[model samples]
Target: MPRSTFHRILSPLLLWRLRHINDRVYLILMSVLVGLAAGLAAVLLKTSVHGAQQLLYSWVPEEKRVFALFLYPIIGVALTVLFTRYFLGGTLSRGIGPVIYNIARQNSIVPRSKMYSQLVTSFLTVTFGGSAGLEAPISVTGSALGSNLARILRVSRRERRLLVGCGAAAGVAAIFNSPIAGVLFAVEVVLSELSAPFFIPLLISSATATVVSKGLYEGQPFVLITNSWPVQAIPFYVMLGLGTALLSVYMLRVYFRADDFFERWPGTFRKVVLGGLALGLLVFLFPPLYGEGYNIVQALLAGKPEQLTDSSIFSVYRDENVWILLLVATASMLLKVFATCITVGAGGNGGMFGSSLFTGALGGFVFARLINLSGLYPISEVHFIVLGMAGTLAGVVHAPLTAIFLIAEITGGYALFVPLMLVTSSSYLISRYFEPYSVYTRKLVQKGVIVHADRDRGLFAQLDPLSMVQTDFMPIHPESTLGDLVTVFRHSTRSIFPVVDAEQQLVGLVTVDTIRDALFDDEHYNTIRVADLMAPPPAIIEPGDSLLDTLGSMDQHGAWALPVVNKGKYVGFILKSAILAGYRRQLLKESE
Candidate 1:
């Protein structure tokens, strides 16, 4: 055989050998492969974003760069949406939403195309200053990698989900080189479970991925280190925590509203034009709002606030007064949300993680400076800036462990663990007060798409009325007499008889119980039509109705079976027994 053909023919044989190996060994081996793949992907994406930034950020004259920042976001959005729509077929959604959704709906199987779609779109998005982070895209890609791999190997759904968690952990770990944070994020946010089976694979994956990412970078540059602060500043950190919580609510409110508006904007062409133009205009006025805004965090930690303000529209007022600095930082936090909303709402790819980090940094800067100005105590703004990142991340994601460890691992060491825990806990508690769901789960909760967390709920979500619809129920026309319904019941043991219109659309449901009173009075049975004996179906189900809603309808009517209708046409019946079986099956699967 030719060399290329020989390898191709040998690959599946190797996979077969690996497949029959000890299950534990096979899992560990596959996790290593997934970790390497995810790590490499994470590194390449970072490099690509940097590369694009280097080219775009260098476009303007050194003295006049602010003037050019506006053009890039629009350019990035247009090209991204254009390529996603016309060239890439369609873009995979970024972040934890799609990952969780796929796990629940598709047996943890993601399409093969997601592996690169996120990489390409997110690179373009964050590169051209699309005010979002690459974490979401990385998360999407990593989950896809694991899912597709599992599918290729024909793993069980449970094992497939485990691999997906491994991929997610590896992706996060690879980017920040924080294995512990990566594992926490996988459990707290992506997998939404802290089971023992998941812990081993996730830990191994994150550690291996960290090694790969660390080796590839040689010396990673984004490690966030800061100066030490006094223990008495815990009170100050407490206030900062509260501020982050409030900011979290503000951002989530703004984000979902923008999401709703842009959802109605329609068509890829319009989203690119309007969303891109809006983001561009925002960036033009607020130069620091460009891209992921990690540069701003670095500037704050280094006590170089001038670097951030130097290019903003407020540059003329830069650092002239402490109040001016506070005002600018505060305004930047608010505008960062606006720019991010435009970036994501307008169909751009990215996550809220970057924006939350930037916003927290600003909050911390404002807090530190204001306290210093009071002449009461001089707290280290760097400490506050670093703590602020964790606090805001905790509030936004409602995953305090992930936030705390991520900040601790990246910020040199855990010397500030006390303050970190205090701030993260407070932020998470306060944010969870009014807004119970995190950014990823908010839409899912509203749409009832978040059925995976609860066994009963997940089972309900898995049972499609269409799939459960039993077509054996005998249906009669409205014009048919009760005698016809009698014949239906005699031939069929089912208690529910559906009366349809001339076109075979359900008009009403006649139960055996209701007609029993009239059946014995048979003198008028021939004269009475099926419609006369029928009650409005106690439970009527439609083909794409939410499973929870369908269950609610059934419960409300005290029905064991509901007639399924699609656009007024009778489809079939979904029995309560089928739903029971679905719950049993899902519960068994989970236990196994």
Candidate 2:
């Protein structure tokens, strides 16, 4: 109770408390910064894409507005093919993984070179009437921003990885102008885990990114839907959900198959040229099928059925154009899928998120129109638009929560929450039940990446701690004399060793540092028992317990090594070197 004793006791506790606070504050502030960058990056990318579209359109003669339908795609494909092949060499992956690849492996590679290539390619794809979106690529840019910044700041490895997720979430939030949805996207899709450790940073980044994204585009989702359906039509959401699920699976399959087919082509330029030519030909038929398909969605929501109903073939026709557009949409969806698959498969630069949405919307439109005509409780086409978007996303990405929330936020209405939930969940369940893998995971699996949690562990939570533990271990007897132990320690390179009783019952551990002083004194060395030199109550882990627990215990005890024990017997000892090696291997495997 004396002042000296109180000071001695309180100082260590205070220091410990300060360190904890500092770590938490550091992670929070970093996450916020990540979010802000993501949001700004998303806006910049979106604006750049829009600007590119404007520039391309301006170059065209007004009389050739329809001609753009054919020419723009050809140009986009040519440019993308050139850039992706000669410059990028095809290391960049679509969607979140390329960036996630950096964080999980390659020491946060960020792919700065690939980012620029994608920007140009995505711009052309969106601007010139290729059916795709900028959402995924934008997030990759944000993630690259966060990873590169963290690398520059010399942030810790674990924190840096978390920041990567933050940046991705922020980018997504900024792109869609939805904060909550962004956070969930990062967690549900990017980080693949949800917990207190990740929640604060991810949330801060998402919120900041949302603010930045909103500041750019009037702060609404890119797609705005306005519909007022009779409450009685709610029941039909079931059929809508079912239709959406079916279409989503079909869409993913078709896209993958097309991609696989096209990838067999002889050369990069040929593939690009053929894909471009095919897209161009489709544009001549239905001008709306070109580029990001935003104009088509806009045209659809306005209910100008003339595009699908007109009879004139080349007059920028109406109703006939709609049918053509529908056929084109279906073809374009298949083409876009193949284009995206080919782009990624053949090493061309792009992201699939946009293409998925484009195809999803088209799928939704067709299904909704069919249901509308069937007199099935008078469902609105707009509802299918929303449901189809969520369903398509859910099936491919396997992130139902992100898909549902994204639809609600982007659509600017919570009214679809119930339906979004029903449809997205069903879509994911059906796709995953049949395939047991999302597009990304399937790719990883094909590359020989053995994932344990491909079924229940979620995408990001698939880290295996047991793989870090070395099965072979060195054992020492507790009854051995200090002199004998010194000789044994001298021949061994391990810094710490598990000491067991003569019967091999668990006892304790001793570090080489502990016996260093006694080595010079011959009498003391010969007299001291191994137990006398050992640190009592060694940190231990059960074989069945998670490596996460082992890591936590080691950190808590400040131990360089932990013993693995079951019942009363010592099983093996985890050398600290093994942990580091395991971390590197696990991360590297994910990156490749």
Q: In every candidate, how many clashes are there?
A: 0, 17
Worst 10 residues of 1 by lDDT: 219-228
After superposition of all CA atoms, the RMSD between model 2 and the true structure is 12.2
How big is the positional error of residue 433 in model 1, measured in Å on the Cα after superposition?
Answer: 2.2
Taking all chains together, each candidate's TM-score versus the true structure is 0.91, 0.70
Pull out the clashing pairs in model 1: none
What's the CA error at residue 401 for candidate 2, in Å?
0.9
User: Mind giving the per-residue lDDT tens digits that candidate 2 earns over 201-263?
Assistant: 888888888877666666354465554445675556666667666766665676657656765
Clash number for model 2?
17
RMSD of each: 3.0, 12.2
